[model samples]
Target: MAKEGDGADSIVAATITDDAPTKAISSQGMESINATATAMTKAKNAIVVVEEACTSSKKPEEPKNPKTQVLIVPLRWMSLGMTRAKQQLVLLLAMRLRTVKTQMMTSKLQEVKAEADEKLKSISGENVLLQINCKALKNENAKLFKGYDDLEAKYTSMKALVKEKIKAAKSQAEAFKIELEATKGTNAESISKVAELLKSPPGFFKKQVKEYTTMVSTHILLVAKYLYPRIELEAIGEGYADGTSEEQALKLINDINGVATSIFNESLDL
Candidate 1:
């Protein structure tokens, strides 16, 4: 600004010098003075106009703005990346949980199968044991049956022997009864003498005869005790001694007496 002002002042000075020459006041000098005056007035007005423009229109200091501004796309890209990372993390966790669940299910299935197999094995073993027991029981039953058969055969033989003994004792008693009847009529004198001799030895047929005679006397007493109005068990003339089953009655009593005598004989053997 100072340089510009100086340049303008010098122009004014030169014009005055020219117009006011002065060899000193010539026609050139007068023209130079008039140009100088006009020029100076124009310079003053221009200076005033410039000062007003500078004061009224010039701006105050501006805030400094950076050469490069923040961009939108890169921020958006970062946010999208963060969201994708979160989604990946969640997916990975879910996949791991699924794998764990599958493994647990597989293990449970295997355990159940193992338990079932164990139970089946136990059942099979029990069945085998039961079969063996059944076979053993059958064998024992067969042996028991054979033992029963032998016992039955022995019982049958014993029954037959007892029957034979009964028959033999019955025949001997019948023969003795016949011999006593025959002697009763034919030996009267001998009977009197024997009775007298037995009475004299001591008392009651020499005392010992009473014991030996008791069984025969008891049989005769029983026949006479409940004698009926008539012996209706047989034909009127042919007596009970003539009846079909009379032999059985006689044999039953004889067998009882014989069994007693045999027991006495066994005492002598001992």
Candidate 2:
């Protein structure tokens, strides 16, 4: 009985030693699980703090207003009033320009009328002067025609007188020729008788010859006095009508007088 009791005590001692080691190992594993749970809780707290900082830093949105819609009505009315005022100002300016243009055109018309009146007055004065000049020219022409008629009448009378004088001179020349022929036929007795008669009536033939010469000279002087002036006047008038100068007309008159004087002297000599 004493051996059996000693073996039971040893077996019980070994079983208690094994149960103590297993309980210590289970306690260390439970400590590691508690540390991991604490770290997970700290990470969840830091993520929540970051989300709150970002949200607080963002700009806020603008709020909508009901008064903005009401203000738009007054602004539209003001714009329409400004447009009507501009149109009124433009119309007034156009009317003023038209009035100014009309005034300028009227002034120009008046000036033209005044100038036309002055021109008409000048033309009337010139017409009057021309009429006066024409009247004077007509009077001068009438006088010249009267003078020409008188000259022509005088020339006709002179021609008739000259014809009568020439006929008388021819009769006298024939008589003288017959007396000369008769005297040529007379002899010495007839010549002595004629000499005795001439001595008794002294200067009878001389007086007759002197009277005939005086008559012929008077006739020739009368013809020259009347005809020479008429010839000069006619020549001067013709030169004037032909647009000759006064100096040229006078020169022509002198030439005609010289030619007439030479002709008259030649006729007298003959």
lDDT of 1 by residue, 163-198 (tens): 999999999999989997775443445556977877
Task: Give one digit per residue, the lDDT tens place, for model 2 in 91-201.
Answer: 222233334445657888889989999999999999999999999999999999999999999999999999999999999999999996675534445547966765666
Off by over 4 Å in 2: 1-88, 185-189, 192-270
What is the model-wide C-alpha lDDT for candidate 2?
0.51
Worst 10 residues of 2 by lDDT: 67-76
Query: Which parts of model 1 have CA positions greater than 4 angstroms off?
Result: 1-95, 184-270
The top-ranked prediction according to TM-score is 2
Q: Estimate TM-scores for all models.
A: 0.34, 0.36
lDDT of 1 at 105: 76
What TM-score does candidate 2 get on C-alpha atoms?
A: 0.36
